[model samples]
Target chain A: MSTIPHDAPAVIDARGLNKVFRDFWGRPKVRAVQDLTLEVRSGEVFGLLGPNGSGKSTTIKMLLGLLYPTSGELRVLGGSPRDAATRERLGYMPEESYLYKYLTAQETLEFYASLGGLRSRRRRQRVDEMIELVGLASARHRRVGEFSKGMARRVGFAQALIHDPDVLLLDEPTSGLDPIGCRQVKDLILDLARRGKTILVCSHYLADMQDVCDRVAILLDGRVCAQGPVRELVRQPDTWRITLEGVDDALRDRLVAYLQEQCGRPVAVEPAGRSLESLFVDVVTRQRAASPPP
Target chain B: MNLPRLVAIVRLTLRDAVRSRVVVSLLAALLLVLVGLPLLVQSDGTPAGRLRIILEYALAAAIGLLSAATLWAGCATVAAELQDRRLFIVLAKPVHRWEIWLGKWLGIVVMDAAALAVTGLVVAALVAVIRPAGGADSQFEALLSARDTFHPDWAAAGLVRAVPAAAGDTRQFEPKSVALLPGHSLDFTFPVSATAPGGPMELRARLGSARPNRAPFASLWEFGPPGKPVSVVTSTNAPGLSMALAVPAAAWSPGGVHVRLTNPVGRDPATLVLGTGVGGVELLVPRDGFAVNLTRGLLVVFARLAFLAALGVTAGCLLSLPVAVFVSIFVLVLIASAGYVQTVAVTGMYYIPLESEAPELGWLDRVVLGVFRIMNVATAPLIRLEPVALLADGRRVAWAIVAEAGLLLGLAYSAVASLFGLWFFTRREVGRAGTE
Candidate 1:
């Protein structure tokens, strides 16, 4: 994917999309998504956040063409996702690892790569790169059926990236991963976005979304309750946060008294603290480095 | 359209079958039917009868077992994948739905071909073991050779007329059989190849009496040139007796094989009626070897398998695993019993109707019978492909018959099935209609 401007064109666009699942007799059973309109710009990370049965997964499925919209339009790469040619430039990692139990991790990647239109030499090269990228080098030959949930998710992630697709629809990217794996995945999302790849992440991990997503749409009860850039949506206009260094306790008490006299309201000042995620990442990194896993 | 994609699906299907033990189970079951059945089953104490047992019973059993396996594999290949949700990832890739359907079909067809080849080899070996000790004996010649038979020219012999002679002549002679008077003589002529080597040939006929008691009857026969005739007399009390008599191949003159029959005036003379159908009144001349005929028989069976594979795969495209298998077996049963369907369609019954004189059908019977009649028309060609029966009788499985089966069963029917399957599956929502 080539580098693009900050305002890159929307690669995944949906307008007033509605998905109403029907029962066996054709009566509407559940309206999973309603007026679900969103756009994922190229070279950006877009997160779809919602709770269970809140239409997050359903919307992702419609974007991937696994489920058709009941009304309105949905397009990926400026074409119908149902088209084979359009899917060639798309990758998807489902929430659950739906892998062939009979195949090795390496074979799984090969199968997807081949279906993704890779030739023999290119397919081999990509399969190798993906296996290595997912840290499955040692388990490349092991049957995916024998893998743990975390390992299977890694395989799923590798398969999605095997074709070097320009757009990735990843559902619950860090659902089954450890802290390190989660951090690694969040870093990969950032890295992919830097390389001008469009990514649509669907998950309930609010902190993970805050770390990686540039824009987000929050769905509740089959409708988009809120949407915008993360900064714009989370910013509080009436408040300001300031971090200061080298201030003595006596001087800080005097400054707090002056602010309280100026505003005629209670004033509080506190030292800024590092986020727990950063601390966890630091502890894990140093421990792994010191142990040098065998 | 994409070759690599199709190859990938086919490879995946093969691996699934192998890992799931489906292929191994099928091979073991086929071996039991092919090798074990021949050794354990009892046959009439003759080389020909033993060979018949192997060709007819054992080979048919092998075909039956393989057919079931092919159908099961075809269904499971798609239905199981869909039910398990493995197709979610694959379908999310740039693969067309037809590629998935066709690739699975090709995989099953390859497995079927390999199994059938194994079955053919084992059956051939068994037949070789049961061959007569002295290769020059009559049983050896009859069992190992494909003989061509020629029937009587009843029309030329004035025994049967091609058209109705007078109005209301409802004597049932249109299908052609003659009732010879007590002492009256009837001349029968069988046209032979004239160049069909001059050796000993056999004459076979289904004989019966027209009397109410169906009493015993005797007949005198003379074969060869009218000048120097070889005479033989044969008798039997069983009505509709299947008789095989030896005739010297030299009896085939430039004109043809000529035979005359007479009812010896007092030799329990009852009016005799002879069948003019196949093997009714004919001379058998050894033409080819049994090996070639066996291969032709196998080809016919392969054609049959192709149709069945198409049927199973198509059924799997729409139904779940259990339901797909049920539909496949149901269709297979109906197709296998096409001949029976035809008979019942005509008589409106399989059993004899008791006190009411004849069977009658209600509305459901009428509709069902109508549907079966239509199916009979469509499956007529399939029913005619009787390879096992022909092979057992040492009759020639002609190349023309094989070509017909290949076109009708293997090509036309399979193409139609594949077209419908691909169309239906391409439109079907892959994420729907599964166990989930």
Candidate 2:
């Protein structure tokens, strides 16, 4: 609930970022990322929200230095993402689940751990811890190829955390997950943030981001349309709703005018109030609260 | 340099590759052929010959299949992972792109090399076991002592009787009058000859011993006008004639006469006389003159496999899996068929023997030949450097193997680069919620 310090240096920093893709004939085909700038400070969960083809993944790729930006100054952990030292402190989970089908959950973590420069003993230990952390300890010996979508996602999460990275860049971490899996991922993100890890999450699930992320950036047409603290941006100003039974048009108009005069803002009348999702949440909450303890 | 890290990466790559059913199946198939072929070819001939045949066929099959598998495996190992976005997790780590590429290539090379070594050893052992029992000396002697005699259609006439001894003499005999076919020639210059007052004798002679003796000889009579009457005479110690004489016009016959012989030192000498009817003259010829060059065959196979594999890997890197495989296999077949096509076309040219004279096809033929010539020039370098050419000789096979390994590594690196480039371009952020 506490606010992140504004003075803290951003773990990820980008300025005037641009990525242009050219066809085989050397002509520009798509301006995947335009001049864009953004920052994410330490110990904060910054979400990059966008629809498909909105350059969210492109921006993330550039930030990770998997791709060289057409023109941009981007840094991770105060160093170039392409730099080994910088990369060692960073973790990434792509939008697609890409675990080696032949590798078991433990092996996947171990392989990644080795790449991150962990010694054998340390790698084994870290892999174990990661498997437990991602709640994949029971299935650590199972090949990733045999895993379901949700299980593969868990393995991916385990690999990302295997190195104990300072910065975590996850692309659709909760995608193709069951409700329980989604909740677990959300909790994991929150837990990592609590551990003072800087997390950059790109996902289409706005509601999930609203619940877990401290701040969110909405990208549109290769540019950020809106970005700020989720709570602050979503807060409605002087907005009120009332439900009336069998209300006539004249009474509604009169009541609207009176409310506007009193509040100095428009008052809307509706036939109902609660959103279906909110009702569902309330029902689930009540059921959980009423259930007997195990 | 992080040796442990590199080793770990290589181990991981190999482990991952082994788990791929495609790789496992291909390797299994190769092993099956390698083991099965020798057993099947065990009965063909001596262990060496059978081994040679089996090894030749097995190596050919292995090279083709393994090359294809290695190329496909190399591309699929990295490219598929990237396509499926699985590589992001590994790339996300602290590993360098080059290291990833190197590790994958090492894994492929290790697996392929292991397979090749096993197959090669099996072939060598089989060949050793099946080789012919005789040593080189015996084989060589057998080759050299083969007869130089020739078969004749007509049966020789009359009995060849050994004459009995006459006082202090060994033996003597005479040949009866023999008719000759027109336009035919005969040479007769014995070690000792004398006319016996039958008919005007036709003497024809030349220089050289009758047998293949190392000594030289001189002619007794000069070749002269046909049908001239001259009594034939030769020294008792004169050498055998080396020349043939034609019976230009007349067919003179002598009633059976004795050909007397005596030693130059006044000792008795053995003599034999033979009779013959009309006959045609012909020279005896040897038939077994050609030898097989095994090295050439081996070299051709090696070069073909290496070239095909290289192109396959290149194509795989440049195109998608299915298209690359198809195109590479097609090119391999095309190249192999090219030799035969060239032979046929050249034979056709010889058959006609005058392309320029055929007005209707002159330009077309010229253009075709020109294209073929250009192709020959372009392919000459490839042919010279082909794996087989490099490895044809026993001494060079080692170097050829090394070069082939280098080529495979190069192709693998190129494929990784291409896949990485593609992955880099297509990757993008879909939403903010998934970021760390």
For each candidate, what's the DockQ?
0.71, 0.34
Q: Which stretches of candidate 1 lie over 4 Å from their true place?
A: A1-7, A243-294, B134-141, B147-149, B162-175, B182-185, B189-202, B211-216, B220-237, B246-266, B282-285, B359-362, B432-436
- Which whole-number lDDT from 0 to 100 does residue A27 have in model 2? 98
Off by over 4 Å in 2: A239-294, B35-48, B128-319, B323-436
Among the numbered candidates, top DockQ falls to 1
TM for candidate 2 is 0.62
- Candidate 1: residue B376 Cα off by (Å): 2.1
In candidate 1, what are the lDDT values of residues A6-117, reduced to their tens digit?
6679999899988888888999988889998898888989989998889987777777777788998998999998888888899999988989988999999998998899
Q: In model 1, which residue pairs have backbone atoms overlapping below 3 Å?
A: B199-B249
Candidate 2 lDDT score relative to the true structure: 0.60
User: CAPRI verdict on model 2?
Assistant: acceptable
lDDT of 2 by residue, B1-436 (tens): 5665677777876787667665568767877776676666554454334444454556556666766666566656654655566667777778776566556656666666565555556554544454445534322222212112111122222233456676665553434333323222334321111222221222222222333443432222222223343333333223433333322112222322112111121232222111232222221111221111223333333443433433443453345556655765665565555564455345434135455574454777767766666555434434444443222211123334435434543344345444654454234322222221
